[model samples]
Target: MSRTIKHEEKYQQFTIELDGDEAELAYACPSEDVVDFTHTYVPKSERGNGMAESLIEEGLKYAREHNLKVKATCPAVAKYINAHPEYKDLLAHP
Candidate 1:
């Protein structure tokens, strides 16, 4: 399946549309230079298609482009970051 992801900056979300359903990676700005990835959701039928991974990747890309650090409050996001070391530098400094 083909998926197109969109970043809705106003909503602080990265979303993907699939068969009329929407999956999203939602975030909040805890500080001017920090993005907290709070949640990610994909409909049951849409799961296992790499939707969540795509959303996380897109969110990370946005963080990088804006020179923002990331706080992965969501387990899935943290897991993704752990698996992808290239994004580790984006993690917010403690």
Candidate 2:
């Protein structure tokens, strides 16, 4: 199914509406050019549909477009980054 991911800059999160529920990926910018991916939440009924991954992909695309680096603090974000080496160059290391 096609879902639209909305970037809520004021809330520092990306959200997707699915079947009357919302899935979100929260992030924080600790610096001018760094975004820390802090949390990912998908409703139990919405799980296993790759919504979280879609959220991350949208977040990463935003980061790249804005020339910001990413700090994968959320486990799901970290795992996605690990599995997708193409995004490694965008990582912000300590």
Candidate maximizing lDDT: 2
Candidate 2 per-residue lDDT over residues 41-84, each given as its tens digit = 99999899999999999999999999999999999999999999
In model 2, what are the clashing residue pairs, if there are any?
A: none
Poorest 10 consecutive residues by lDDT, candidate 2: 16-25
Candidate 1 wrongly placed segments (more than 4 Å): none
Q: Which runs of model 2 end up more than 4 angstroms from their true locations?
A: none
Task: TM-score for candidate 1, please give it.
Answer: 0.95
RMSD of each: 0.9, 0.8
Error of 2 at 68 (Å): 0.5
Number of clashing pairs per prediction, in order? 0, 0
**Residue by residue across 4-85, what tens digits does model 1's lDDT show?**
8988989989999777889999999999999999999999988898999999999999999999999999999999999999
